[model samples]
Target: MKTSPYGAIAFRPDARRLTVSAPSGELTVWDTSDPSRPRPAGRLRTGRGIVAAAWNPSATDLLATVSNDGSGALWRLRDDSAPEGVARWAALPDRPRHVGWVAGGSWVFSMTGTGRTSVWDVGSGACVGRADLTGGRPVVGAHYRGSEVVAVTDSGWARLWRPGRRPSEWVRLTDRPVSACTWSSTMLVVGDLDGQAACFDAEFRPVHTLRVARERPRALACADDGRLVASAGDNQAVAVGRDGSVQWETYLRPPGAQSITIAGDLVALSAGRPRPTLLALATGAELAGGRS
Candidate 1:
């Protein structure tokens, strides 16, 4: 039997663990403390194919996932036992595409493919807020911090929304459609179909731009110190510095990277393969057991 490609990948910085989800709803946690030889730590099954997932910023063992079945769930990882579900909600009209946590993990939010967002209180599992974007374009990427939510669309517009407030006017980021985006406390990075990555400040002001790939970037991750890592259709992973210079590049096998995350001194990259590859963040060198 053929294996399913990884649908989502998330990194827990504090624990040096990488979580990879398959379309079959299996979530595998890999211990990456020894980056040269990662081993599976644990697993959780959602019973529904997950589209995206995010780790809680304040709760180290908490995770949120959204599924193709129009449901969303929260899970808690236990050291002595298998991971278990904490809460779940389902029967929504739209398919959720992304999930995130905010307010120090007290609340969770999910964004659907149609630009509808629902915020839920983690304690009661009750939805506290809802926001919608009426434009025809689909949301390509989104990032949530505190109470602010930023979403980028295929129309090349990025907009900010908060609970109980109207979404801000569209801010154009590029002429080409955005493919992926990631943000840190200090900066927001957006990748476009034209293979360009644009950096912006917290207030959405343009900071810099760099051509990171020859084809549309499929995944991006940014470090707190302003280092940016990206994987694109060109089958190459490139790292860029804060000064807007290419730091290093590593070629990958065909069908390139699908998701990426920065885990301390390493980059955990997932192509459409069975396991994610670990690369040295500084030089983009593949570590042991990362050979495809």
Candidate 2:
């Protein structure tokens, strides 16, 4: 399917399909049944530009997207039909960075780049709890499992919060501002624009700083097999083993690599602009599939 230049994308946990929200305000879904020849299955056009989009971990059909225009929208989508846009939610503070579903899909979490994160009940659409991040700090990102929530801040700190209890003091790590962060198994991967990707052992302590392109984008993913950490950015791409050794890297032009995802040894790297081009994860092989 077609996508805007390096627009944010998310692979469904089931891996049956992937969803991408492009800068052109089009959301496309890809059918991964034939991995080598993934094709478009659906498309929905939005009225505003998209900064980021994510799938609800608890409910696959439920997706949330944040508009760069200071608004957030939720959609309930299905196959062979138009996606239902379920009411528009505005961002009064004018900075909603990321969104996700919580409370068994009964609540929604919207975090801004300016240190304001709020949880809204799905049915009533009323905020149940709000976390004021203060100090000109932005929430790096946030993830939820059951009742627990883990959020990282721009100041290289992570916090765990939920209904009740004082928001825990920030767990400081470094002075670097985080670009992207993700968790897998028991390890949480934190990446920065300074070309450092560090792994923390649950407690957010430094286990190792995995290496890749210098000053790369936050395109780091842990292989499900726990063998390699693949990252791409800085106009280059590299994969390092868990023990911290280079496994594969692109020597030619970087494909202008934007993000990296690992499903087994096969890596999927997205590069290019306008309509981004996706390259084979391993060997930096290029696939000529035209943008939809």
Candidate 3:
């Protein structure tokens, strides 16, 4: 089977559904009931490259995407046909780079290249709040967890804020710029260009740090068992235990991994390869021939 390079990947909250969006704006959903061989479930075309996507926490079939066309859209996937666009908003000053759902999918938020974050009401498709968070630095990545959003900038700063309020928790993660970030139930993990993954508590206190990659980590995901998985571009994908020890590392093909998702005991890596690669989260061994 032929496959285009993927720009981003996401798994449903339940981890049963996986979505991979290509640079051509084609989004494909996969049924991961058998993690080794994910069957294509559905597809949607946005007409522009998707930068990021997030699944609705409460509605499994609902997905949100931020596109290179300076728009954000919500899509509804059906079993019988291609997904439909339920709501879309455009005309932003900068292209949105990251998107996420909040308030149990009642609202959606996106962050742009200029550090502008906008929150839209899903029901009305109206942007209810907008804020500039750059503070003279470029935002590298952002993560939405619960009602709060954390934005990390190239200046090595991370700020936690809620809509209509100033940042309540802010911290300087490192002197080196951060590359990726993700949230677990009780912890926030940030990876830096220095090849380190740092864990912080709820109050922005440093808990521990693990060296996951030789250079920058392209993506980071926290597993259910408190392990940190990181993809280092052109390097390798690694899983680190809670004790700041390396659990396993699997080398990748050139151009390396772009994104990662962990569901149950399986880890899916979207890389330069033709198809996504599946690895055993516990042992880092390829599964089902490693192509899905």
Candidate 4:
């Protein structure tokens, strides 16, 4: 088996490729046409700890990477003319802790630790507008609910905003802090410290609540088709159906699962057991005979 130190993992939207981030400030691309045998394709050096990355939806070859040095850069992965330099970069006042693409990848949004979310033009690297989320509390997480970006504060509040527009429509999901969240075109799912995963409709109305155990769910993932939801905690992982019924649950061995991502019909888990594991999205059956 081959292994390397990776901090985060994301599959391409088409499920044909996988990207992994290393703590040493580099990205490794893997060919996942054969999920059973992921072959390393290439690597991109970003120069610092790569905290987050997002692949453009419309342009599959473009990627955005956020560094620990309070900077963000856009890279054209398949560009042969300039293989070393990035396409664009924007230096911000504070370190961008979270990032995602919006407006069909034409714009990028970044959030900082102090509760500020900034929108940037992908091609020009200009800060188009900013949202002050620090209205007295720090933002714990941020997500996109359709075309609007929602910031979840540590105080159990969620607010929606758009690029170059004012934030509106405030809602509260719980009294405890949210640990993880994932979104669909018509719904928003959040995992809280109380070991409960809640689902909301397009209008932010509570629709379903799922609780498996007492442990906090640190990782959450949702299928793009909005048919499956997955949550991983210290020692267990659970997949739920759209109707809020538990589809399947698997208990991880030892140090337990550290991250999770759902793509197509597979749920990929990065656990502390040295090698990642793949499970069936419908039944949680261990894939590849329990190996990755």
Candidate 5:
């Protein structure tokens, strides 16, 4: 399959669909019905270039993307065909730093580099609420859990906030920049540029920390059961136990690791090389024949 320079890759909540967005404004959708082989399903051309994207939790065909052209677009993709211009539900102002759905796809949330976050009603296309992040740093990523949003800043801080409300909790994670973050059922895992990753419980208590490699840990994923965590960075990848013990470590031939996604015990790590390789989170064993 032909590939481009993608900024982020997102697998649907059900792991049935995959979306890859390039910085050149190309969006490719893949059908992952066969976990071992993902076939390109459709493509959407956006001249502005994508910065970040997220799939709606409850809707398979619905997703949101933030582009460098200072616009955020909500799209309804067709499973069988390429998306056209009309598939865009709405385009909002300012380039979003991160985007995700909230309230079971009832609303869309977008964060900006200026510490501004907005909530839009997905059905009505109305601005429902907005909040200012006082962390004084650009938000790199955010995950919606229950009624609160956990956001990681460029300055290595994680702050929790509710729409239209002030920040309720904040934690200083590291001095080095946070590269990526993932949230599981009971844990929040964050990777940093210093080649370190940390896990925290729901109440923001530190569980374990691991120094996985010498390179920046750019990609991170955790098991839903909170038993394992994995990180890939700078040509090195490792899975660590909940107690911070190394389960496995290997050198990646790729130049860098792009993203990590975990579903159940299966973890997908997308290296800079494009295709994502599947590994067992429990044992760090690469799942054979399941490269997407």
Candidate 6:
């Protein structure tokens, strides 16, 4: 109900707020403190179009949204009013669609239109390093769990990049792209475009392939304690527990949900056209069903 599908979504660390970007060049935050009734707390407009949006983990009211027009702006919200511009920003030679906050630091990571990824020092807003990505439209987002940051490109490949030994030398993970990828604490679940899902280690080596639809999933979300939720274009979503149990199942039923997220025990889904709704994990039923 809060975020727009044209961009990206990042949940605040406390799970009380969410930031979403839409095709209208807008980014908004929703208050989820009371899951039974989510409310739009604040909103910000982006330049050009939003390529991606990410929430600052520790700072609940801060967010960074990147645009395809090659500019990144940091917005801070104190109340529901328009966001106040902040000090962090960047203008690159190429447009970037994916961005994330680095763990243990204020650095920001981004993937460019040319399939190039880079890290920036948020305080100084300077580029620290860069890596080449397997060419594609661009990555939608970058994820970091530990020391390694996983960047998934539009080509359906997951590239692992750690800090280079020296100045600009990055370790190339592989020439081959993984079909699909989502991460847990110690494991990564990769779904290929070929209609298969595989598990991999931190070293990017294959371990196991899982059973599910192999036809490329539309969205993927995982819980910190090791639960995986996947939804294809088919409108049905499946919750796969880490211990191998069915958590629940439900369909949005109409215009279809464009994206989903797990906050606490609730599954928040954004449906297209009609409106957005939140479902309880225990019953797979809507908590707040509102018209768009």
Which model scores highest in TM-score?
1
How does candidate 6 fare on TM-score? 0.80
> How much RMSD separates candidate 4 from the native structure?
4.0
Which digits, one per residue and each the tens of the lDDT, describe model 3 over residues 1-292? Answer: 0112585688776666777776667777877777777778877666377767888878878888877777888998754667788988872567777777777788888887557788888988777677776664677667765787778776678876688887655578777678777676678777788778888777778888887778887877788546555454565888888887788888876666777877677777776543667778888887644343
Best by lDDT: 1
* Candidate that beats the other on TM-score, 4 or 6, i.e. the better one: 4
Per-residue error for 10 in candidate 3, Å, reads 0.6
Model 2 TM-score is 0.80
TM-score of each: 0.91, 0.80, 0.88, 0.85, 0.82, 0.80
Off by over 4 Å in 4: 1-6, 78-86, 212-214, 271-276, 288-292
- Please give, for residues 32-72, the per-residue lDDT of candidate 4 as tens digits: 66666666667766636566667777888777766667677
Candidate order (TM-score) = 1, 3, 4, 5, 6, 2
lDDT of 6 by residue, 1-292 (tens): 1133533666665667766566676666777777777788776666676757777766767777777676777778765566798854554557775676775547667667445667776787787776665445345335775544566554555555664522222333334344334554456565555545555566656665554443555555556555554443356666665544556667666655556666566666665532346777656777776355
Clashes of each: 0, 1, 0, 0, 0, 5
TM-score: model 1 vs. ground truth:
0.91
Predictions in order: lDDT: 0.75, 0.63, 0.73, 0.68, 0.67, 0.60
Q: How does model 4 score by TM-score?
A: 0.85
The parts of candidate 3 lying over 4 Å away from their true place are 1-5, 78-82, 167-170, 233-235, 288-292
Candidate 5 lDDT over residue span 1-292, tens digit each: 0112554577776776767665557776767666556677776655377766787777767878766655667777767666644334334466666777778778777777656677777777777777776445766668776666667776778777777777776678766777777777798777777777777778777878776556676677777787777777776668777767788886665564567677655666554433556555566666532233
In candidate 3, which residue pairs get closer than 3 Å at backbone N, Cα or C atoms, i.e. clash?
A: none
- Cα deviation at 117, candidate 6, in Å, is 2.0
Error of 2 at 207 (Å): 3.0
lDDT of 1 by residue, 169-207 (tens): 988887777777777768888888777888888877899
Per-candidate Cα RMSD to the true structure, in Å, reads 3.0, 3.8, 3.3, 4.0, 3.8, 3.9
